[model samples]
Target: MGLNAPLVSPRPSDGYDHRFTEVDYLRGMERLVHAVQELSLARSLSDIQRIVRTSARELIGCDGTTFVLRDDGICYYADEDAIAPLWKGGRFPMTTCISGWVMLNRAAVVIPDIYADARIPHAAYRPTFVHSLVMVPIRTLEPVGAIGAYWAQERAATSREVSLLQALADSTSIAMENVRIYAELEQRVRDRTADLERANEEIHQMSLTDDLTGLTNRRGFYLLGESALRAARRNNHHCLLAYIDVDGLKRVNDELGHDAGDSLIADVSEVLRTMLRESDILARIGGDEFCVLVTEPGGDTARLKDRLAEAFRTFNTTQARPYRLSASVGLALTHPESSHTLDELLTLADELMYADKKAATESRAGGVNTG
Candidate 1:
């Protein structure tokens, strides 16, 4: 290349090479602005590498450019844009490489002849096209890396070339810092999003559950029961809802205190849980009143009722409690296609439960009279 080739603009009418002229200076400024813009938009280390390697060479009109990172005790030639391959993807000790020296010294160096410079590792440069070079630290006060511009022939880099290289290196440092900031910000957003999701799920579960028995509450029953009914209607299936009221709850609460009454309710909940299948939806709909909705097509209400009676008998026989446990259960069976809503079924079940309580009271009175 000619003396003015690197910085010359197009020839004017006078056929003069306009190097170091106002036109050439404006063009250099334009290229530098474009490079800085590219660096500002870089999102990662690799992005910085790609932009720097290409833009540095273009701005300085060098034969090659390498972006070298200072890795702990080593100088890593991370990326390069060159006429031929430089030491890309290679690592050297901090004391052995020119790029490392630039970073350590926190200053730029212009080497006209690599052989003559005592800092140059002559054996290392013997086979390469690099003979003269200008290397600038990325950050001056505390350097993180270096950018090197290389030439195949021995030539002194002008002051303008060194300044341009340093400016680009400074921008590279800022771009790298921005990448770190963006990564941390993204991680925090992900963590906050996860925390919110967990909180929402816990709140949702609390709304649907009974505080004392840990069973599904009335609100849950209606929400889930309505959905189940809708599915049954679509599939032409049947549903059986059993409303169970704990017998003599008022007496237990009054005589033994609300604490014993609570124990009784919890015991009954356990019995129901033991007797019911995993698919059964059991809920504590009211104080001492529990409801079970069986949506399975093959469910037998009679068998379910028998199981409940047996479960209660087993609980009373096994536990030494002040009060005996018993429940009045009423089952309302219906096809969803009949247009019977869950509310209607629950109302019907409640009435049947009252009738069942009446029958049990009458049977006990009759037994006492006979005795």
Candidate 2:
């Protein structure tokens, strides 16, 4: 029974009650409290390992220490610290390992002979200097991991020694629990924060865009048009502001219903989109009013107006819609030498649009295209 016998015990309540003196007991308690307190500050699994491994190896007067955790149904030899090399990164199954037996039984075992115990595999200890050891389940309730203290020479483990190791195991359980809870909380906050950012982005996009046509609304027009104006002014370029009104939006709304009016607005937007370059700014400013900022150095407003009119004519002739679509456009130009602001430029375009509307009303085009 030299170094292969099993001695199972329930710790401090075990048969070796008279082992510790009053002074030694108090000193051990003080050290145990300090160690357990430090475990709370450990933020990671590695931190927990470093704290437990060093403390167990030193406080228990052992040559080495190990922290074996259970993963799935297998016992994982997760970590260790020793004066000599130990099983720091090896794994063992629950069926044949001593650490597994203690964990499986949810009990503590002090082995004076590693070769003698049925649970101990002979070949496993042949390479190491661990002749005897004490292993304790991390939790008495539901064990997650185990802590082991290994001795170089065969010796009977004192009741005090096994008790301290059990205490360390229990402390580790609490420390790991704290780390798990903290990690879960951090992940949840991160996920929630990401969700909020996405929602805010969607809201901001909605604010800048018109719900009907998926086009830039008045607010978006002002913001983007201002930036385009600044760039044009800096680069000594020409900028065109076009004020447009759908020719028969109200009549279409009255005759064909609001849905037809909406369809007409979308069709007009498509024609306007095709008339401008990618760098141009187009926005639906009001019910049937739109604005455009052409950003080229020498843009042709006449050509753009003609193209939109032609596109509308082509679309109206090709598609059999309830009503034809047409637009009355007004153009105002801003160059580098111009002293007018964006608001003044837009006002000038609107005035030109009203003048065009007045002229068209006076012409004999049916009952005077009334405003």
Candidate 3:
């Protein structure tokens, strides 16, 4: 008979000793101990497959072994270590395969004669040397896969061999569970980190922004204004600092409600945004005070003042309100190659703004409306 032909040895009824010797038991135990250690360190499914494929065969003294995974209703023979090829990278229907039966039943099976057993598809074994086999589920509760050991002759699988194979499958199941848990933990940490970064960025933006006017606050002005001043000085360019205070804000707040004062401030901020170029740095530094830093050389202060007066005139003519919108403006110009600091320029602008406010108040002493 050919080597692949059915080689059915008589069963234990013929008094043949089918069990391995005590020395073989010791060797199997030694290999199993080492396999458990390796499995404990496995990080992925492929790692488990690699460690189990060879270790299972050595531990059970099988002619061939296969690591099978249950892919939905399909049984996939993913890896194998054998004397000859035994269905590596092959797929079969879960209902028609022995490994699938083991996984679906969540138990182990030991087949002594491939041709006699109804569970074994006899036609599938005709091309191979497999005559007997032992299949065990990876997990007894909810089986994920199965480990199979095949022999070239008919021999009843001893209880010890089945136990050893089942132990290996249990370890593999634990390793796979660990891999899943580790992946979930890693994803959760990444998600939390992204959330924290977004929150921190929002907090930073809130710290530098004025809540009422939606403009830069005093801290932001100093931070960005210093950078602009340094750049202007390095280029030897003339820069201007303009300080403006809204007129009659306190009077409006005292007469009308604070809501009207807030609306007036918002309107003033909108007017300043419309008058200034996009590159100009504008900030609300106090309750009724605003500042602008123009870094470019040759800014026209007279034209800017004229545009502000015209805009206020148009607004007062169009809007019906208890008080008109007006502001006292003062400017401090730093010449090219000047050594004036940003704080010094702001102080100078504040002094000039107070002087302009005094002049306007005196001019209104002739019974003329100032706002």
Choose the strongest candidate by TM-score.
2
- State the weakest 10-residue window (summed lDDT) of model 3: 362-371
TM-score of each: 0.75, 0.79, 0.67
**Clashing residue pairs, backbone N/CA/C < 3 A, model 2:** 3-113, 3-114, 4-113, 4-116
Instruction: Give each prediction's root-mean-square deviation over alpha carbons.
Output: 6.5, 6.1, 7.3
lDDT of 1 by residue, 1-371 (tens): 22234564443453322133545445656787898999899888999998998888777677899999988989999999999888899999999889888988998998988998999988888878988899999999889999999888767776666777788888889999999999889889999999999999989989999999999999999999999888877988888999998887899999999999999899888888887888778999999899998886465767767777777777777789998888888888887567888999999989988877776753441110110
Misplaced by over 4 Å in model 1 are 1-26, 43-46, 68-99, 110-133, 151-156, 271-278, 314-325, 361-371
Report the lDDT of model 1 for residue 110. 85
Of the candidates numbered 1 and 3, which has the greater lDDT value?
3
Per-residue lDDT for 206-235 in model 3, tens only? 888899999999999999999999988888
Give the whole-model CA lDDT for all candidates, comma-separated.
0.83, 0.81, 0.84
Best prediction by lDDT: 3
Task: Encode model 2's per-residue lDDT on 227-294: one tens digit a residue.
Answer: 98998889888889989888888999999899999999998888778767889899999999999888
In angstroms, give how far residue 34 of model 2 lies from its true place: 1.8
Task: Indicate the TM-score of model 1.
Answer: 0.75
